[model samples]
Target: MIETSTSICEVIAKLRIAREAPYYGREYAFGELWNALDRLDDREADDESR
Candidate 1:
């Protein structure tokens, strides 16, 4: 799993770039990736609530 916010952002950035390529996840099969991104957003929200 993504360990740090920097790492998470890096991976999401790469994944999004890859996603734009043709024939990549045509049906968007990797739900965990999406979940991780959501988790990152949730984490940010939690941090901001402090």
Candidate 2:
């Protein structure tokens, strides 16, 4: 799960910097993606604790 979240984060970071990125036009998409990754990371940490 951590790997999945990390990979997603990496891709998001790339999209944030890409020339044709639509994040500037559709900022909510970026926000949603980031929040999703954060949730995934939090869920993974919670599972590890349990």
Candidate 3:
């Protein structure tokens, strides 16, 4: 899901950059998103290994 993650990351990055972004105001959310994506990737990898 590289395409999906890339697109989402782009939008999230944009939001994180804007000071007026309500949800993105908490910068930790950005890292959380990355972590979540990593977890999803790991899960997918595990599934593929099965």
Q: Which pairs of residues collide in candidate 1?
A: none
- Candidate 2 local distance difference test against the native: 0.65
Tell me the whole-model lDDT of each prediction, alpha carbons only: 0.63, 0.65, 0.62
Q: Give the count of colliding residue pairs in each prediction.
A: 0, 0, 0
RMSD of each: 4.5, 4.2, 5.2
Which 10-residue window of candidate 2 scores lowest in summed lDDT?
14-23
Could you tell me every candidate's TM-score relative to the true structure? 0.47, 0.50, 0.49
- For model 3, what is the C-alpha lDDT against the true structure? 0.62
4-41: candidate 3 lDDT, tens digit per residue: 57656755665555535467455765665666567667
Q: Which structure is stronger by lDDT: 1 or 2?
A: 2
The lDDT-based order of candidates, best leading, equals 2, 1, 3
